[model samples]
Target: MNSSYANKSIAVLGAGESGEAAARLLHQEKAMVTILDTAEENKLRKKIDALGAEGIRVIADLAAEHESLHGHYDYVILSPGIDPAVPLVQHFIKRRIEMIGELELAFEMCKCPIIGITGTNGKTTTTQLVEKMLNACGVKTVASGNIGPAFSAKVNESSHLDVMTLEVSSFQLESIRRFHCQTSVWLGFAADHLDRYRSMDEYYVAKIRIFENQTEDDWAIVNYRDKLPALKAKKITFSAYVPDGDFSLREGVIHFRGERVLAMSETNLRGSHNAENLMATLGVGFVRGLSFAQMLPPLREYKPLPHRCEILRTVNGAEWVNDSKGTNPDSVEKALHSETRPVVLIAGGKDKGFEYDLLTDLVAARCRSVVVMGEMADRIEAIWKSRLPVANAGRSLEKAVELAHAAAQPGDVVLFSPGTSSFDMFKNYADRGNQFRALVQALPS
Candidate 1:
C-alpha cells in the first residue's frame, strides 16, 4: 500500500468501469475519495450507492453549488474515455494539480511484472493467447485492461504474484508517468480511432508509450512489418509476412530463431492476421523458456473470442458470422481477406472518420452484398452501392440480419463485420455482436 495515498483527497472523474474500479481501490487504501460522473444516477446507481455507503461522496453532476470541490482535490484520476483536452481536466492542469489516468494509478499500486500488449488491432486476441500460453506452461497469470476486469479491480482482487497480461489502449497510455512493463508486444498497426486522436503521428506516439519505461532486462516484441524506433529493451521482432525476424510463421509452423515453436494447423486459429497474433505471443513464450509442446496444448484448445469472426450454426445451409469487433477498416479488411466463401456483409456503425476507399476493392471482389446500419449507414452505402447491392438496415440489428439473410444463398456467409464503433444503437461492440447472434439465430432455414 502507498502511504502517500492513504489520507489524500482524491477526486475520480467518470463513473465508468475503470473509473469506479479506480475509486474503489483508492477508497480501500483509506483515501478520502469523491466520484463525479456526467451519467445519470440510475445508470450507475449501484456503484454510487456502494461507494456512498462506504462514506465516499458520490456526486452525479458537478453543479455550480459543488464546483468548489474541484480545486480542493489533491489528485484527479480521469477515465480513459474522458478526454484530457476538456476544460474541466484543463483546470487541474492550470492549477498544477496531479492529473493521471486510471491505468497510471493501477501502475502505482500493482506490484506484478506486466506483459503489456497494444496496437491498432488484435490486442484482445493476442492478450488472451499470451495468458493461455503462460498458464499452460504452469506460470500464474491474469488477463486485464480493456478486456475483462479493469486493472485496478484486478489489483484489488488478485495477489500481485500473478503475471498480468494487459491489453492497453492509447487512451490509457496517454497520461502515464512511470507505468512500465516487463515485456511489451506491439502488434501490427493501421489507421484507427482517428475520432479520438488529432493526427496519425499523435496516435502512434501514444501507442509507443508502452515501451517508454522498459529496462535492458525487459523484452520488447515488435512487428517487422510496422516501422519502429530503437529502444533500450532487448527487442524481438515477430512476423507472418516475412521470415527476417526472431519469430516467423511460415508454412503452417511458427519458427523462433530458426527453431520450430508451434504450427498454425495445430491451433484453432486461422487467417494471416491470426498468424501474426500467434507469432507475437510465441515470441513472448520463447522469452519465458516455453516449448512448442507446452504452448500447443493451450493454442489448440483456444477459440476466437466472441465478436471476431465467430460463426454461428448454419441456418438454411448459409453461415452467419458475428464480427462486430471489427470497428476499423483494417480489421474488417482482414475479416474479408480471411474468408473464402462469398459474403453478404453487414457493415457501418459510428464511423471513426477512417477512409473506406481502401476496403472497396476487397468488398467488390469478395462480398456478394452489403447491408448498412447505424451512424455511417448512408455514407457506407454511398461508397459501396456502385460495387455491390447495398441495402440500408437502418440502426436495427434484426433488420440488418434480415437483409443479409435475404441476400445470401446456401454456401454463402452473412458476416456482421461492422467497420465502425457501436455507439449509435448498441451499448458496445459486444452487445452489438450478441444482439446480432440472437437475431440471426432466429432467421429460418
Candidate 2:
C-alpha cells in the first residue's frame, strides 16, 4: 500500500503531456496508478503502450464506465484541460472521490524549494527570465509547471539549482495545499479562465493561492497595481514606472532601487510589457543576492518566448509576429499597444466570456484590419466591423495568415495575437505558432 495514494487505487484522467508525466512519476513512487481517457484506444495506442511498458494501467473510451471507475479509484488526478464542473468531474465529486491537478501531485513529491509564479499574461516569460538570470548567477534552477516540463518529471538529486522556478497556472494553483514557495511572484492578474471557474472572483482566488502557504519570511513579489495579492503576502512590489520598489524602468533607464542598478537604454525584447517583465525578474534576482551585473548579459540577449510577441520575419519592410500566446482580451490589448504602427491583427478562438468590445476598442484605436478565426470569430468580427476591416478566415489560421499578410502594408505589422485559447484550431499556442511560421515561410519572399 502506497501512503502517497493513501494506500488506495489512484486514477489519472487525461493522457496529455502533464498527465503522462504525472502518471510516470506516480508509478515510480510505487503507486497503483491507472491512466484514463475518452479517446479510442487506437488514437491513444502509443501513449497506452508507453504506460503499459512502464507497468502502469491504461483505460480508454470508458465514458460509460467512468462513474464505476471513479467509485473504484481512491483519487482522480485531473489534467488542466479538463473542466472542474464538467459532468464527468461532477460525478466523481458527488461520489466523494478525491480529485487533484498534476501540480498538486508534483508539489507533494519534490523536496526542493519552489518559486511559484502566476498571472494572466506574463507568467511564462517571467519564469523563464528568472530561470535564465538565476542560471547566470550560479543558481541551480529549472522553469517548469504550466507550459513546459512537469516539475515532478524534472526533479532529480544531482540538479544544480537550489530552487525551482515554476510558471504556475490558475488551474495548477487550484488544488495545491502544501506547495509553499520560498519566493512567490504574482506578476499581475486579470479576468481569465472565467470559463473554468464560472466567475472572476473564483479565478482570482485560485491565483491568490500561490502565496497561501508562504511563511512571513518568504517574499511575495507582486505588481504594484494588484490589490488582492498585495494584501495576502509579505509584499515586494516591482513596477515599470514606479521607482520606490526594487526595480523600475523609469524614463528610459532600467533602475534598481535597492542597489541603484540600472541597465542600458535598450534591450533585445520589445515593448514596455517586456520592460515590466524584466523589472519583476530583476527584483527576484536582487532579493536573492544575484548580482544585477551577472544578469545583464542574459537580459540584453534574452529573446521573447514564442507566440508572445515573437517577431517571425520582416518581409517587404513589414514585421510579421506570431503572438499566439495572447489568449485573452487583456493580452491582446497589450500586444496591440506594444507597437506604434497600425497592426493587421489576427484575433479569435474559444471565447472565455471576456468583453470582446474592450478588445475591439483597442483594435479600433490601433489595428488597421483584423483577420478572424476559430469558434468565436463571428462574435469578434461583429464587434470590430465598424472600426476596422473585418475579414473572416472561417476558423483556419493558414487562411487568417494569408488574409492578414495580404492586408498588411509596408511599415505595418501583422500579428497573430489571438484573444482566446488555441484548442479550437490547434493543440496550444506552440502548435499555432509553428503552423503560422511554416505558412509564413512558405509564402513567396
Candidate 3:
C-alpha cells in the first residue's frame, strides 16, 4: 500500500467502472475516499450499496450536493466520462486541488512496464493483439485501460504481470500528470469525439499526451501515414499502404526493415487496417525482445474481435458483415474500401458532429444502396441521397438491416458500419452490433 495516500482525502468524480475501481484502489491504500456520481440514486442503487458495504461513501446525485463538496478533497480522480469543462471539475480546478485520472492513479502504483496503444480506431484490436502475443511468448501480461478492465482495477496485480498492454484513449490521457508508457503505439488519427472536443486539434492534443512524459529510453510506435508532432522517445513507424516504414506491407507480405516478417495469407486477420494493426503489434513485440517466429503462433491463431467487419453468415449468397465497432467516419471508410463486392451499406447513429459529405464520393462508387438509421439518419441521407439510393430507417436498426437486406443482391455485401456513436438508440456500439447480428440471423434464408 502507498503510504502517501493513507491520510489524503480523494474524491472520485464518477460511479462508472473506472470511477468505482479508482475509489476502491484508493480505499485499499487507506485513503479517505468518497465517490460522487450525477446519476440518480435509484439507477445506481446496487453499486452504491455495494460500495457503502465496504465503508466507502458514494454520492448518487453529485450535482444536487455539488456545493457541499467544497474544500473537502485534497485530490480529485476524474473518470474518463467526466468532461473537464463541467462546473464540478472547474470548481475543483479553481480551488487548486490536484486532479488525476484513473489511468494516472493506476500508473503511480504499477510496478510493471506498460505498452500503451492509442488512436481514433484500432486501439482495442492492437491492445488485444499485443497482450495475446506477449502471453504466447511466455510473458505475464494483462490487457487493461480502455479495453479489458480499468487500469485501477488491474493495478494490484502488477507484481504478477510482466507487462500491461493498455488501450489508452484521449479522454483517459487528458487528466494524466506523470503517467508514461515504456512503449506507446499510435495506430492512426482521425476526427472523432467532436461533440466532446472543441475541434479536431483539441482531440489530437489529448491523444498526443500519451507520449508527453516519455524519455529516450521509451519507444513511440507510430503510423507513417499520419502527420504527427515530434516526440522525445525513439520512434518506429509502420505502414499498410507503403513499404517505407520500419514495418510495412510490401506486395502481400509484412516486412520489418527489409526482412520478411510474415505473409498475409498465414493470418486470419483481413483488411488493410488489420495489416496496420499487425505491424504495430510486431513493432511492440520486437521492442520487447520477441522474435517474429516466437509471436507467429498467436498471430496465426488470433481471431478478429466481434463487431469489426465480422461476417455473421452468408444468407442466400449475400454476405452480412457486422462492423458495429466502426464508430467513426474514418473506420467506416476503411471498411468500405476493404470490401470487394458492391455493398448495401447500413450506417448513421448518434451525431458526433462529423461531416458525412466527406464520404460522398466513396459511397457513390462502392455502395449499391445506403440504409440510414438513428439520430443522424436524415443528416447522412441528405449528404448521400444525390450520390446513391439512400433509404431512411428512422431510429430503428431492425428497419435498417431489413432495408439493406432488401437492397442487397445475391453477390452483394450488406455492411452494418455505423459511422458515428451508438448512444442514440442503443446502450453502446456492442449493443447496437449485437442487435444488428440478431436481426440479420433471424432473416429468412
Candidate 4:
C-alpha cells in the first residue's frame, strides 16, 4: 500500500520483468532489496544482471542452501507467475512472512488515479479500449499492469496523467494489500486457474479482491449478470442480456440510460463477448465524463489484438484466424460461436484442468474439424471426439497449423484457438501465436 519504504529489507521473488522492476523501484526508495528465482541463473540473466548492476544481491535457483537466508528479509514481493503455493513460498507464509505482489508495491508508489480491469477473458481488449477512450478525450493515459510495462516504473514517473488503465489478473490480485483503482471493472469471472488455485471458490475470491481497498467514492463496473456480494464501491452494470442495465446493448445500438450512444456496426469489434467489453469501457467512460462522440473514433477504428480471433488473411477462399489469446474454454467457446464460416479448430495445449463441456455445443454447430496438439492434445481430442471428428495434429506447432490447413476446405476457417497455456511446447502463448501467423502467411495463395 502507500507506506514509507525507507530502509525496508525486502526480498523480491522470481527475477522476471516484474520482479526486476519492483526491486529497482524499491531500491530507489532506499529499500534494501534482494532478487530470488528458482529458474536457472542464465535463463534469468537479463533481470539478474540489471538488479546486479544496481548492487542488489540476487540468489538464483533457491534450494535448501538459500533457506537460511529467508529469515533476513522483512517482506517478500512475489511476481505474478510465481505461485505462493511453492513449497519454499509456503514456508515463508506459514511463518508469517509479509507477502505482497508487485501490484500492491506499485500502488504504494503511484500518485495518479488508476482504472483496474480484471476477468476470465476480454481483459486486455477492454483495458486497451478504456485507455484509448481516455486518451482520445485529451486525458493522459497509459495501459499498464499485465499488458505492458511493469507498474513499478510509474513510481519514478515525473509525467502527469489523468489515469492509468491497468489489466490486472487474479495472480496479481492474490497478494494485493492497499491497491485500489478509482474505477474498477470486473468484466466477468469464471472457473480459471484451476491449475494454480486449490478450488474454483479460491480463484473467484482472488478476482473479486480488485474491489477490496476501494471506498464508497470509487466506482465498480461489473457484468449485469454477475452475482457479486455486497461491496464498498458503488456498482455500475453493463449487460448484453437485460436492456435495463446501466449500459445495455440491444437492436444494434449501445444504450446509455436507454439513449443511443453508438451502433454495433460503428464499432469494428465483433462477437457478443466484445459487446460486453465495449459496454464495460463505455461504463468507465461515462463515470469519467467522456461523451459518446469522444469514444466513437477508437471503438470504430481500433482493430482486434493479434491472436484474439484476428483474421490473418483469406487464402483460396479460406480464412485463417489467430485466437491464441483464447487460452481458456470460455474464450475459445466464444471464438467458435463468433465465426461465420465453417471452422477447422486448431485447439489444445498445456492443460489447465478446464472443462471442455461448455464448448461442446458450439463446436458441434460451427467447427467441422478439431486438430489438437501439445500436452493436453489427447485429453482435448477425447472431449470433442464424441461431438465431431478430432484429429491429433502432431507435436510441433507448425505441424498443427499445416494439419489444420490441410483439413480446411475453400470456404472453411482455420481457427487457432488453443484453449490452454502454450508452455508445454513453446515459450508462451505469443510465441505459439506468432509461429501460427508466420506459417499461415507462408501458405500458397
- Candidate 1 lDDT over 1-445, as tens digits, reads 2336888988888878898888888988888888887667777778778878887777785653457455587888988988887765766677787778999888887777899999888999999999988988988888999786899888754464567789999999998889999999999789888888988898999889999999999999989888898888998898877889888877778888888877778778877789889888878887878877777788778999989889887988788888899999888888887789998899999978888888998999999999999989988888989998999988787888888888888999888888889988888999998898888777766
| Cα-based lDDT at residue 9, candidate 3 | 87
Per-model lDDT = 0.85, 0.79, 0.90, 0.84
Q: Candidate 2: lDDT over CA atoms?
A: 0.79
Instruction: Please provide, for model 2 over 123-239, each residue's C-alpha lDDT reduced to its tens digit, 9 standing for 90 to 100.
Output: 888888898888888888888878588776776532555988888888878777677888888788777776778788888888888888888778788887667633445667777
Best by TM-score: 3
Off by over 4 Å in 1: 1-3, 156-162
TM per prediction: 0.95, 0.92, 0.97, 0.95
Better of 1 and 4 by lDDT: 1
Q: Model 2 residue 114 lDDT? A: 76
lDDT of 3 by residue, 70-102 (tens): 747888899998898987778778888888888
TM-score of 1: 0.95
Q: Model 3, residue 58: displacement in angstroms?
A: 0.9
Give the best candidate by lDDT. Answer: 3
| Candidate rank order under lDDT | 3, 1, 4, 2
